[model samples]
Target: MQTSSTLTPPAIRHDEWALSDVHGQYSDANSHADLYRFLMRWIDVSTHLNIGYSRFGQRHLTNANFTRLIDRIARPMLELYDDSVHRHDRRLLDIGSGRGGAAIHAHQSYGLEVLGIDITPYNVERANANARRRGVWPAVSFAEGDAQDLPIPEESRALVWSIESPAHFPDKKKFLHEVYRVLKPGGVFAFSDLLAVPTRVRQWPEFYKEFLRVWDVPYLETMETYSEALWELGFDLRKTEIVTKNNIDIYTGYARRYLTYFRIPGFYKWYTGRVRRRWGANLDNVREHLRHSYNALSRGTIDYGLFWAIKR
Candidate 1:
């Protein structure tokens, strides 16, 4: 990744809130509730908490179908198994499950029992409500828990799924170990996340550092690092692929939506006011971080990856 020194850095208004503080805020129920409410109102109607993937390439996607694209990203994980067996016996664990979208989809589409866990209690409650609304309440349940320290029992889940969520984890290694611990032997752990290209990170240190602060992640590991970690943790690294184009498409779609939303009368004012009130001085930092992320994605300083591994 080429570093552009010509780009002007945004002013940092909030010096008190460090990366650790931001991470804590995410786990704070009240804080995350406010954030989720804002996102639901402004981002997408379908309650997707992550970037949606686009298949027809970046040129053809619109905000209207962006939510559907999110579901599409999860389809491959669901299709990994044969659903011919008894549905009640098949358990799928969704780590960092947001609003139960993927959980409900798995239950309704594949007849699998889904257990969705999130760090925020409010998100867990919202997920349960969404599950009830989707009529998959009993089959799909949500709990408040951390991905790094899962509440699940050993050999409890047949499949552990995470969608664009591990990037938020402060410790990816511990989370991967937890996933391996909870999954049954021969079970699969599948996920998608933003990754830093090792070569690019070395070249663009400033951009990479800003990305960590903005993204609320401690560090972004390359695909090679992930494979090595998984292999060392007794996982059979089945698949790992770079999907940077899809990530670019998703960010582009979101940018379009943000612009459209800004055009709405008083929408930006109201949204910004709410965020500032809730987050205080950190608001400007948040905005700057997002700007940095968009630019980084466009420049290919970062990449999106999809990975699947079976517990050995």
Candidate 2:
């Protein structure tokens, strides 16, 4: 995960998001397609992008039940999906679907048709190839689109889920409105994202600010903001789960291990050499990003939240 944050450091208020602030190596390089590919090239799965979940007594980075544990993280969201009710149009819309890991998993595990929309065209192409490789091409497909303004039609989808992608979204409230606009009357919507603990975040810039800068995250919306928006947008919030205990420390530990390993000059060269020269992301930036992600998460400045609701 050689992620380079484009956000300027010394962030006075990382949570205060603005449209103009999306610059530099953030989405600019991603507009060229190669940035996303280059940044996440080392990840094991071509279709995987999200930092997966880990449970109690389970080592997240080296868990014997890694796949099952990841699936368990999504179980809360999946519970809101009524397979019977979604029979009319069974396509599960995955917004901000990076490389289609969650999308393919949905089709493979639940036998449902899935449509994944991502902002990066390269990822869309790569995700499609991955689906074909898994023999789920037609059943699971990827397209390039924005979450704030979906290309999908209004009131057409029965189920929508986003996994750990909304943190990068500049306008989470607008994204939620778009979700509400697209789903059927009783459509189920679910997502997992980094949520802010306002006071904690304000108190820990040393750990959290670097995380915002390295990850190129605009800002995180709080549980209050999102839950209130859900009701105001006409959705009945079925559940809100804070799973920091199971996830943050695990991912943080993974980064700590990588940071340690990267300290070895031989290993650093090996990893850097692997990156394409044209789209080379600063390895230092990636390390800083990864380090702070875990640090901030483990310290409680930020949290991982899963929210699922039904359209009223």
Candidate 3:
């Protein structure tokens, strides 16, 4: 993957929380509770995929499927460190650890003591439940906490990880600061997420508006701004990989999969029930926006980024 020097455009922000609507409309009908559950499930799959877990399954990583992802993420970083000099009883922290798959995988497979945290109670609870269900309880625990003010002590964590969650944070700088604070001296942090770029330089405002309506998340920062913020917060750059070209293919494949998965007799009815009830008036526009995302991705106008850094 190639890293680009050109700065991406600033993320779009909306006064209204459009993401809540997207969650409400897309999940099953008549229940905001159900919407919450659906969001957690989606995050689990997305985070795993974002971090290189290719297989899609709800069950815990039982077969070789789970360990492959565990090794993929940790083995490279571990190799980069001095084996004889590094801490053996290293403490790892995972921010926004959806479903605890990554944490449990790390603990059981790599023998790393881990703590997974998420703001969503549903995710936290489900993750903890899954940990126990997999018999990795106590070793891998989930905590309810905000990423902005991490509960971990300063200079305590050997490694920190976040996948696809920071984009939702309203303040990226503060969130970066928290990650920096919790990481031990010389600790490594790995992060990956979608990058926002202006549709056209002069049409930023219009593109920003389109951005929120499409992703339902606010305040996604660009790769340039993100790197600058990390440096400002005292992190030494390790490696930056631009996954945009590949992510375009990945997301395009996802959209196709979504279409096939949701088009099933019972599944389509399950998905569009609330969408029709709540946004019946704007259904066409919503469909149009979804099409634009798929088309834009296929054309490579948008992309995802992955990077690693060390606390300086």
Please, what is the whole-model Cα lDDT of each candidate in the order they appear?
Answer: 0.66, 0.72, 0.63
| Predicted structure 1: lDDT | 0.66
Predicted candidate 1 versus true structure: per-residue lDDT over 207-229, tens digit per residue:
66665655556666667667778
* Candidate 3: clashing residue pairs, number: 0
lDDT of 2 by residue, 1-312 (tens): 311221111234456544333333334343222333444544444557665666678655432233453376456655666543765666889998776777888888777799999877767887898989999998999998899999988998988888888988877889999999999988888888887776677678768776775566777777777777899999999998887777776667667787888889998987776654644665665665666676777677788888889898
* Top candidate (lDDT): 2
RMSD of 1: 6.7
- Give the candidate order by descending lDDT: 2, 1, 3
| TM-score of each predicted structure versus truth | 0.75, 0.79, 0.72
Please, what are the lDDT tens digits per residue for candidate 3 over residues 113-222?
77998876666777788888888788889998888999888887878888767766767788899999888777888877766664542244554455554555565677
Put the candidates in TM-score order, highest first: 2, 1, 3
Residue 26, candidate 3: C-alpha displacement in angstroms: 12
